[model samples]
Target chain A: MAPKSKEKPKAPTPQPPPAIEDLFASLHRNIDKSDYEKAVKDADQVLSIAPNDEDAIRCKVVALIKDDKIDDALSVIQSSRNLPIDLGFQKAYCLYRQNKLEEASACLRGRERDPETLLLEAQILYRQGNAAACADVYQKLQKSGIETAEVNLVASLVSAGKSSQVQKALEAW
Target chain B: FPPAFQSIPRNPIVLDLAYNCITFPDIENRMKKTRKGLISRFWG
Candidate 1:
């Protein structure tokens, strides 16, 4: 009898692509863990399946921002259309980092009172030599229960030439 | 500003605030919503 032929090894079954939900979960986890490079890559994968996925777009942009790819983040925001979520604050932040102060201030129009917005606004004011206005914004933040603003308020007062107010603010801090 | 703060720039202070306060839109929360259906016009 002829020896039985050795059976051919079966080819491995290709694994199915990951579900969008799974990809999204990973992206969120990466962002939460501050692993922004991985988050950006995961977001890009999600975007490939759903090109207009706003969640993916926003996550990618924010991850880029966190990763210090500010220009890329801003470009993505600019190019995307009809985003469900408003990324104005993030855009303003990118502009501020690029030293485009006036543009950053403009991007934050109509959202001046938001604590995040106020913080960015204060930074811009401080950079622009409007320390008094910056101090006022920091004071507002402090009144709103932001304890860290106390230190910033003292700094702004010093820059604004308010030595007496600085002493008071410092002591309070 | 104290001697220490005087040397530090606005960059660091606001960096902390931005990271703490500005959170990314949650993926699960946004995904749970049903997608809006396209509107169709009917001819009488």
Candidate 2:
């Protein structure tokens, strides 16, 4: 009689945590270098595993912005607002990018006084050729002692007749 | 004075830096560290 063969258990497939982490790391690198397409690809891979990752969503939005797809970025950010309050500023930024000045201002209105938001509003006004209004807002922000990079840049714009550059700078932001 | 300038509403810039979520020095430091980690791994 033949001896009964012992059955062996098959090994479980390993989960892909390390690979996901590597993908995020690569995405972060691409973002730092302003390589939007590669960053978007890496973020997509991470999102495949963790579909609702906040950082991944942010990376994808940034890539969309870098690609000059402002409307798409706005949509992504608007959808992300359901996640958390910290994402509110990002949503406002998307609105700004889409040239939805009123909506962007509304998103930021009555929030705690954010210097960046103020500067962003001023930039939007400048883009609309409301130079005096933009300057007034910039002066108010300056008087409030909120000396952010955005504030400085806006101040320069107000003084330099570079209103056209405001939109470009906001995009870079 | 132009009518636009005359009608320019004065929106007071609220001064509450504490409540504003502007990136502070500590946050900047953390971001730098994270950037460095990513750069070291990928760009190095």
In terms of lDDT, the best-performing candidate is 1
Docking class of 1: incorrect
* Top candidate (TM-score): 1
User: DockQ of all candidates, in order?
Assistant: 0.19, 0.04
Using all chains and alpha carbons, the TM-scores for the candidates as numbered come to: 0.75, 0.56
What TM-score, to 2 decimals, does candidate 1 have?
A: 0.75
Q: Model 2 segments beyond 4 Å from truth?
A: A1-18, A143-173, B1-44
**DockQ of predicted candidate 1:** 0.19
Worst window of 10 by summed lDDT in candidate 2 chain A: A147-156
Give fnat of each prediction, in order.
0.29, 0.00
